[model samples]
Target: MSNNTNQAASDLQRNELPAKKPKKSKTLQQSDKKLPFLLLTPTFILLAAVTIFPILYALYVSVMNFDTFGNSSGFAGLKNYMDIFASSTFWNAIFITLLYTALAVSIEIFLGFNLALMVSKDGKAMTYLRWLLIIPMMLSPLVVAVVYLLMMNTDMGILNYMLQSIGLPKINFLGEPTTAFLSLIFVDVWQWMPMCFLIILAGLQALPRDPFEAAEIDGASKFQVVRFVTLPMLKPIIVVALVIRTMDALRTFDQVFVLTQGGPGRATETISFLMYRASMKNSDFGFASAGLFIVLIITIIISTMLIRFMNRSQSA
Candidate 1:
């Protein structure tokens, strides 16, 4: 009986002992360390194919002369870039692009902030209005341009018809230079203001209630609260909105294509439209590529500055 009891106790102790883990091989450990990079290989390959390859090709083409038939004709060195830089049209396009970006982004930011402030409340009506406001941005830019093109037609368009009905002379909206530029700005503001509004409204919603509550406790008026507390906190978000709109406005092509086609003697010719004309109209691919590189450099600089500002604001 004592031997059987001792045998049972030894069996229980053996069963209760922890099992030893098998050691991983060196190769397996190395693979585990590299798994994240291996998983990202496909994404890196895709970026290389789409982005890096095109940029490199553009750089190559920018230095080489291309024939009218789109065949590479020999090395042209910096001739293409020099020609583009010397052209008055190129400078004009740059100025117009900058002007458009500044006006559109500023107006959009101003109107969007006000609209967001007006509707930043808890109600079904505000929710529905927000959805309605975002609908314009959801439409395709080309489609918006086409719609405005029809509406702005001078002879039989709705705007002119209304003006004539009110005993006013029909005003040429797109036929003139200043009106055409302003009209383009109006269209851009109409379509993109909602994006700014949505972004600012989201920022407003996400802002901490502590500051506002504190201001209220101190018996601050609404304007004082907004001026002191709201604007400072919302600066980063506004800058983000500005950066996005500025980049987009700088590359505006669809509206220029459909509405003006850089008409009224290049009054509204943006850099993007100029590039299109260089490549498609004049068959000067080298010039177009050089222009593209210049624009790319400018865009990179602007975006870097904006990003740095955003970082500083956040850190502060």
Candidate 2:
């Protein structure tokens, strides 16, 4: 009888163990819900401090007259903004920035597409060359500036040496204002075109095989299929790439800063470089902040429009 009772008690204990699992799982589920937020907390706080706080502070500074001497001459209202708008230098910088952005991005997109086409073929050599092309995009703008400057310098640079070897005159690339602007555009294209190539290549590779197969069966030529089907399908990716490259081009500074310092007489001066000079060199924080705010607003508006366009294309 005692052995029978022991066996019955052991069976009851085993049944109760299963019942306890619900309570344990409830605790785990609660922890799972909190885990993502807990993990994200530090990143959110850091971004708030670094990005959000600075932007807000700049807004406040934009409203007041702030000199680097820590002298806050009360509120200047929109005077700083008005002054910036009235300045020819500001307008010229804006023009230069737009022109540089357009030239660099357009040329890069065209060249990158061709490069992507070349490397899209299946082969070991082409695959290796694709990665080699990517190396330029991975380099920092400052490093690129230094390297290009060394190579393109008028007197004793390798490029001029090559020119002389070919019975051509040495060009003053960074000295003449026009050539300086063109040189900056060239460097930008060389560095960023790889990005456009990679994106377009990915889009090309992911295109639906069935559509191409159908087109081939329908006796559509390669160029016709690309024009009607592939390009339409690729519109969204192209837009995204162009928008990203355009924004980055607008923010050009480091390479230009090191290479020309906005010279051969402000030829390569961009909007970003203008703000940097105003804040750091001229010590006019208020004016700089106003200019920065204008840039921020324009960027926000343009980004919104581009994003909307991308969304529409994706949906279609």
Candidate 3:
């Protein structure tokens, strides 16, 4: 009887034991590891097709010579680049591009920072105002340029009409070199200031309350606190905004195209406009390609410098 009872308990224990799971095969494990990469293959291919391929082709074309009819005539062996560098028009475009970028970005940063500071406090009116401010940025640059073009018209435009009503002289906004350049800057600042404001406001809101509390406890003045504490904390965010605006400003085309078309004696001709003229109007694809590479190099250098500065600020 004891042996039979022991046998019955052993049987019960054997029956209650869980079944072992099957081990995955080596091939199956390898496939599982590579699954993510396989899924991402399509995205990589698309990026290469759209971005990398064009860049490579442009580099190739930059070395070759193209006829006025857009036919590739043999390799020019850097003649295109030499000619572009030798051209005074190219230098002028570079100067205009730099001036526009610097002025527009600086004014945008200053106005955006002040506007952000003013509206940073919590209130319904501030909320509505913030939305209204963002509306300008949301509009397309081309659309904004077109609207301003009409408004700045000297004869019957609203701006000129208003100025006349106020007994002020009618100003030729886009017809004159100085006013045209400044007008472009004004339009750029009007449209993009809100971008900086939004970015800075987000940064301000994301900042830790501890520092401000500590400043308050130490009886620090508002100006001192902002200069010492807020500015230091906001450096990275400001640099990010600066880099974005700088790159966009450097590539400015629509406003110049619509408002001035590189007119008024090339006063507003940006590098982009110059390239457009070279390729489209002159049909010199090789020259345009070379110019594009030069612009690319300049952009990379500026971006690298800004990034290094940001890193240094963060480290310090």
Candidate 4:
């Protein structure tokens, strides 16, 4: 009886000693979302410092009238903008850029969409073709330019020789204005269309099969199925593709620079190429900075609109 009493006393003492406190939950309640925002503050600060500051600084510099020799500098207050508006050279460059953008994008979309559809079809042949199609995108843009330039050379070009062999006239590919433009367009299309094709193909492959099977049971024709089902589902992916490709195309420099150098009276000179000439070749930093700022604004506006549109479509 004494031993039992001593054991009970010990148990009571141990229980009374203390219980370890419980740890606080690491995760906050869903309502307490502000913690995440607090954690992200540094990222926001860094982005503003790097991106926002430069953009604002460029805009400030554009309004100033400066020259290459660093003389005749003063606050012009939109005079540079006004000059850009008045210059026929600027207008012509804008026109050609728009034309190139439109043609390249349209062709890329159509051909890429079709190629993606074909490749995603269930077959061994398509699988092999898809692998092969990715080769162009794997090559460097500079290497592509060099190879195309060689192929487009008027005197020693394989393309010209092939045409001549077929009893056709040897056309000056990179020399004349029209042919120069066409050559550049072809090279760009060849290089980038594969990328679009791959993107769309990935989107197509990721789609759930139920909608398609259900549509088939509902007696939907091929065109009707693609129109009502596939296109709607692929919208988000297509928007992503558009954003990436447009940004790249707008800043097109390597191919045009290597192939033509804006020759034949600036026939193939894009805005990017023009800015390079101004900043690097002519050493006109202030003017080039202004032009680059304009390009940046246009890019931002376009990207914002596209992202908003895509968000709305996705939500709907």
What is the TM-score of each predicted model, taking all chains together? 0.89, 0.86, 0.88, 0.81
Model 4, position 94, has a per-residue lDDT of 67
Candidate 2: tens digits of C-alpha lDDT, residues 95-166: 899899989999988887777767776677567867788899999999999999999999879989999999
For each candidate, the alpha-carbon lDDT, in order, equals: 0.91, 0.88, 0.91, 0.82
lDDT by residue for model 3 (1-316), tens: 9999999986776667664222336567889899989999999999999988998999999999898899998989999899989999998999999999999999999999888878787677568878898899999999999999999999978999999999999999999999999999999999999999999999998999999999999999999888998898998889889988998999999999999999899999999999999999999999899888888889889999988987887677
C-alpha positional error of residue 60 in candidate 1 after TM-score superposition, expressed in Å: 1.6
Question: Candidate 1, residues 1-316: lDDT per residue as tens digits?
Answer: 9999999986776677664222335567778999989999999999999989999999999999999988999999999999988989988999999999999999999999988888887667569978799799999999999999999999878989999999999889899999999999999999999999999999999999999999999999999998999999999899899888988998999999999999889999999999999999989999999988888888899889888988888777
RMSD of each: 6.5, 5.8, 6.4, 7.2
Better of 3 and 4 by lDDT: 3
Per-residue lDDT of 70-166 in model 4, one digit per residue for the tens? 5447887877676666766666776778788878877897799888887687778568878888899788878999999899889999999999999
The numbered model that scores best in TM-score is 1
Instruction: Give the per-residue Cα lDDT of candidate 4 at 286.
Output: 66
Worst 10 residues of 1 by lDDT: 17-26
What ranges in model 2 sit over 4 Å off? 1-35, 68-70
Clashing pairs in 2: none
